[model samples]
Target: MAATSRPKLLAGRKVLLLADFQFEDLELMYPKMRLEEEGAEVSVMGAHPAGIKYTGKYGYPVKSDLCVDNMSTTDAVASYDALLIPGGFAPDYMRRNQAMLDLTVAMADAGRVVASICHGPWMLCSARRTDGSPLAKGIRATCFSACKDDLINAGAQRWWTASSCRAGGPFITARTPADLTPFLHAIIDEMAK
Candidate 1:
């Protein structure tokens, strides 16, 4: 029998990427490109408005096409199939923004796919469910070693140090820049389903 070809994994799906100043360059760009390659439409969303530009940790500038604060319509979170939070010092600042937290909570509560790497879980911890629960409370996750304490305190039950990536439910997390490959693959796998 002739083998049937498979369609693009994430065709017709939309993904939202959240970030702020000092985002890790590779973590954000790599997955964005990969997602596009798999036929997913990816939008870069920041803490501010569309005109705002965020510089990456290595000096790359990424301008936002969508902003958390600009999402006033009720269907904002419903428009995307998944949310990706790239790591770096950006997460530290992102976690402090009420609008950003609200967006994350909406995504998590809607059961949309969420992926975080390095320091990205900082936002996840802060912007959990709408009832103010921490998304990591009982989820297995991995982030930069420095974030272990905060992640646990924020309620991650098991913080994996030996693994580069962990996926629980609709959430996926990676340890560091070295794990970006597996991290993207995990997100792709999630979206494929």
Candidate 2:
């Protein structure tokens, strides 16, 4: 049999993985590698610029290539094709940063792909529409069970706690680390479409 030819499905695409200290290791690393495997340029952006390192919940360390502060300019956040928000205590901290919240809100308003998992929805809950409505309003989403009330209170139309993943509009969300595969596959499927 002849070897099969594979397409670089994400060729030329740019993805930004947002996180900070205490981010879930698997959720962050897996998607980063898989996105790269599909030929996308993946950059990790944090609260600080390049050279600042953040430790994951499990002690994994990743350096940020860009900071949310630098993303104040339109081009900084608008240039990316998608944004990936991994779960953990990181989202708790990330949501408190005005710049981070602005970036998330900008990406959502732009209708860009935003893939988040587990506690990742925390950041989503913190985002708001230009009209000042919660961004999660009427959006189908899934996240860690602990976040269900927060999601609903923030206005998620349907938040699935037991499901592996849910994709609605430009948002793709998953419940936990175990759901990472389908979570990312859902994202790849979205990008392909």
Candidate 3:
């Protein structure tokens, strides 16, 4: 008997997962499962090539798929249909990486869907757009309130606070992991569009 291959809903759609330090475990896992459930190919990318273990706020370790260094931002951003930035301390770590920021900027500029939750929007904030503006400027978005405050204080114009909100362009933002259901749904919908 031959083994059957997994069905591919996102047969040609590739997704890039960016993580580092800590990220809400459930937030990352649920979307990965949902996307894969619909046949999207998901690849995890982080700072280390050996794979970084995701820890919760409490420091409990979680598994990762691949390392960011192993994959080039030029390649992943260009090849993938969308990019998923999970929130937590991980976004803080991602913000410091130039390659990650560039890839995010490229994905958004290319009109590909860029979905984020919790603190994930920080990476978006780091990517300076062509107009010398934050990628999220003038775009309605939501993230961990703590991070939202930082964006607002930093002069990120047009940011609005909400439990969950999807804003201008192909961006979806959620306040926390609890807000992931709608966030994931929006991402799938955007991919379909």
Q: How high is each candidate's TM-score?
A: 0.92, 0.94, 0.84
Candidate 3, residues 108-128: lDDT per residue as tens digits? Answer: 888888988888888778877
List of clashing residue pairs for candidate 2: none
**Better-scoring candidate (lDDT), 2 or 3:** 2
Candidate 1 accuracy as lDDT: 0.87
TM-score of 3: 0.84
Q: What's the ranking of the predictions by lDDT, best on top?
A: 2, 1, 3
**Number of clashes found in candidate 1:** 0
Quick one: best lDDT, which candidate? 2
Q: Write the per-residue lDDT of candidate 1 for residues 1-193, one digit (tens) a residue.
A: 9987767899999999987999999999999999998999999998787968889999988889987877852476669999899999999999998887777777877789989999998877887675667877878888998888878887886656868999998889998899989999999998988
The local distance difference test score of each candidate is: 0.87, 0.87, 0.77
Candidate 3 residue 153 Cα shift, in angstroms, is 4.4
Off by over 4 Å in 2: 1-5
* C-alpha RMSD between model 1 and the true structure: 3.0
Give the count of colliding residue pairs in each prediction.
0, 0, 1
Score residue 167 of candidate 2 by CA lDDT: 90
Q: After superposition, how far is residue 145 of candidate 2 from its true place, in Å?
A: 0.8
Tens digits of per-residue lDDT for model 2, 104-146: 8888777789899999998888987678887788889999999
